[model samples]
Target: MTLRACGLIIFRKLHEVSAAAVGDNIEYLLLQTSYGTHHWTPPKGHVDPGEDDLQTALRETQEEAGLDASQFTILEGFKKELNYTVKGKPKTVIYWLAKMKDNSAEIRLSSEHQAFRWLALNEACKLAGYKDMQTTFREAQQFLCSQA
Candidate 1:
């Protein structure tokens, strides 16, 4: 059976693209798993018993990235789902678009992850390390651009 997971694609707006001023520019938040493969991705994990997908997304985002739905605005009409195999087992991930209102929102990590990054589109795709995840990043960028 395929595993199901859900998460948020959190981003902030930036003035310029300098590495030193990333926080000042819009960046996407991706976390590096402390577990197998040390893969970097948006805050996501297996869904829990009887939980709705959005609730699961919110919960995982909080647990993995320390941001709650209340702290960010979840853009309406935008959600991305990715399907792929991890360890040769079918897996599916659902991602919702969100923007951290404060931009400087503090992030607290759980044991599931050892590191985190706020990356631009290209950088994020490279760190994602999975074809399915890379496509998700592209779709997300298109969705955000359409909103403007």
Candidate 2:
């Protein structure tokens, strides 16, 4: 059986910049997992039974990051699917792009993640580590840039 997961690529626009220059102001949220290789990623978790993909994304974001749905605005047009294998089993992860409603909103990480950071596009890609994750961030940055 395949393992499935979903998450939001949460970002905030820095208040120091103008709304018209969203590209310069955008910072992506990344969480550093407490376990394993201590890999960094966006808030994500396995899909619970009876939960749809989008629901799983929102729930996991709230549970892992302490940011509820009201804290951010989901971007309707951008979504990404990543396929890979874990322990010899295939896994799929879906991610939606979202912009934080308030740039000053504090991040509260659960025990699953030891730390979190808000970084610009290039720095986010470097910390994300995995090739697929890097690609995801790049695409997300591009999407936000286009919106500007």
Candidate 3:
């Protein structure tokens, strides 16, 4: 059985700069897990019983990253899903695009993560460590660029 989950691919437009400079100005959010391999990921977790996929994404974002839905402009018409296996168990993760309304919102982490970062795409991909997640980041970047 697959471990199902969902999350957001959140970015800040860097109000101090322009979109042409987004390659340098954009920052992707990555959280470092406190458990297992201490893998880095976007804010996400296992789906709770009876929760809808989008609801699970929002709830996990709030619980894991201390950012509420009002703090972000959840982009419409963009979604990505990843399927993979962990420890021989299949897992599926859904992601959506969002732009932080407060570009300077301070992230407060829960016990699930040890650290967080606002990284550029390349650095984010390198730190993300897993191929699927790397592709997710790329797709998110493409989505945001299209929105620009």
Candidate 4:
């Protein structure tokens, strides 16, 4: 069976900028897991039995990043699904784009993560490790840029 997970690509605009320039102001959130390869990724976890994909995304974001649904505005048009193998099992991760409603909100990490960073597109992609994850960040950046 394929393992399924959901998450949000949470981003924040650092300062006022014109629509054409907004891309530079945006920063994406990434977390470094405390276990295994210690790879960095967005807040995500396995989907609960009865929870819908979006619900799981929201819950996992809260549990892993300490950011509740109310703290970010979900972008209506952006979502991505990545497929890969983990421990010899196929895993699928779904990610939705969200803009931070309040950039000042503190990021509180759970025990599952050792560190978190809000980074610009280039830095984020560099720390993301895997090619699939790097592509996801690129897609998210494109989506945000298109909206500007």
Name model 3 segments beyond 4 Å from true. 16-19
Compared with the true structure, what per-residue lDDT tens digits does model 1 show for residues 1-148?
A: 9999988988887653555544335579999999888989898878999998999999999898888888999889988888878789998888898988887789999999999988988899999988878888888787766555
For model 3, how does the per-residue alpha-carbon lDDT over 1-148 read when each residue is reduced to its tens digit?
Answer: 7899999888886666666665667898999999998988999878899999999989999999999999998889889999998789999999988889888898999999999999899999999999988998888887767666
- Clashes counted in candidate 1 amount to 5
lDDT of each: 0.85, 0.92, 0.88, 0.95
Name the candidate, 2 or 4, with the larger TM-score value.
4
Instruction: Put down candidate 2 lDDT per residue, 33-114, tens digits, no spaces.
Output: 9999999999988999999999999999999999999999999899999999999999999999998988888888999999
Steric clash pairs (candidate 3):
none
Which ranges of candidate 4 are over 4 A from the true structure?
none
| lDDT for position 67 in model 3 | 95
Which residue segments of model 1 deviate by more than 4 Å? 15-25
Task: Give the Cα-based TM-score of candidate 1 against the true structure.
Answer: 0.88
Q: Write the per-residue lDDT of candidate 4 for residues 57-84, one digit (tens) a residue.
A: 9999999999999999999988999999
For all predictions, the C-alpha RMSD in Å is: 3.9, 1.5, 1.3, 0.7
In terms of TM-score, which candidate is stronger, 2 or 3?
2
In angstroms, what RMSD does candidate 3 have relative to the true structure?
Answer: 1.3
lDDT of 4: 0.95
What is candidate 2's CA lDDT for residue 50?
96
Give RMSD (Å) of candidate 1 vs. truth. Answer: 3.9
